[model samples]
Target: PFRFSALTRSCVVIPCTFQYEEDIPLTRGIWSKKTGGIVFHNGQSNVIDHFKGRTKILGDLNEGNCSLEIDDIKPFDNGPFCFHAEKGHDKYRFNNSCVFIVMKSPEKPVMTPVPAEVDAGSTITVSCSVAHTCPSHPPVFSWSVPDLSSEISHTLTSPGIWETKSTITFMVAAGDGVRSLTCTAIFWRDKQQAGTVKLNVK
Candidate 1:
């Protein structure tokens, strides 16, 4: 069955199937995310990494259902996710694949920063946000600061799926010039982390 959703930060179910003629006790299915010419491993062994805490498995493994539950969705996550499932048999094996299209809300995302450019010794504020996903729940912002080598601050407003923002403060100096600063906001609904921007300090 085909599914669609107006909500940007939401998980959509895609029904899939895999069958084998032999009596196989265990059938395995694989889920992979393709982004920027990189294939992110979604599921393997028992659980997924980074995605383990966020992703939910809706399909029945024994029944040969390979449907996936994508969480913390984002616009960047929109792509042709290839789902493959295989059933091993005595002589031959069976496999299947499918694609899903995740739609985003018109609201999209708008990032706001306290200062576009910061000085050597000061605090910097960067807000990662989305216009709207639903009325009851608002978007959250989460900041990602790799250069500072410090922890990030995340603010949540509603359902874990809505949005998250990260904020950080840094005291810059000549030594920090080689380092890079970045802020990332991940919509919990689809596990979509947006493109990172370089922090500018004066």
Candidate 2:
């Protein structure tokens, strides 16, 4: 069983793989809900309307990859899903191989810089963090400063929740007084929120 978390109105990828006798040729792949509703199929005619243009197969069938991607995810999309495949003249369905999707709303990020003030020619570190409920789908952090060196880490804040932090270090110059550092957090479904901190360089 695979568990995944995503933000509503975002996208999610379900990882899948299959193996069979070397002589068997893989024909097609399918992704469906627990109720047997087709989310995606190699043939267009069989796919459900709600998932027609929103779903895609991310892997090559011939190589035994059956991964699926769901776009514009909705709250109702939360649930268990399964994969099916066709190999030569035989069809295979692994009921036990399933994924459970959990969706949540996104939150704004928090930014912190130690000392808040720094001396010219001094080095400083700024940290940006955010809390998210899905460790399986942790939020991604990025800095607005171009070519900036940054490090990222995550901690389990609680059951099923995680806190991710991104720290960036830079040297301050006398002329670079009153500068602002921006941090952007990207969550599932591509939803993004950002935070900024102002620095006073003496």
Error of 1 at 102 (Å): 3.2
lDDT tens digits, residues 3-111, model 1? 3343445554445566643455554555655332212223444443544543444667667665565555555555565555444542222343535454764444455
Indicate the TM-score of model 1.
Answer: 0.38
In TM-score terms, candidate 2 sits at 0.66
Best model number under lDDT: 2
In terms of lDDT, model 2 sits at 0.76
Off by over 4 Å in 1: 1-6, 34-52, 86-96, 106-202
Give all candidates' CA lDDT scores. 0.47, 0.76
Write model 2 residue lDDT over 1-202, tens digit each, in one string. 6787766776666667776556667777878888778888878889889888988887787777777778777888876888888766677886556888877667789987467677877777778899875444578887766434778898976533578888888776567478777789998657799988787778
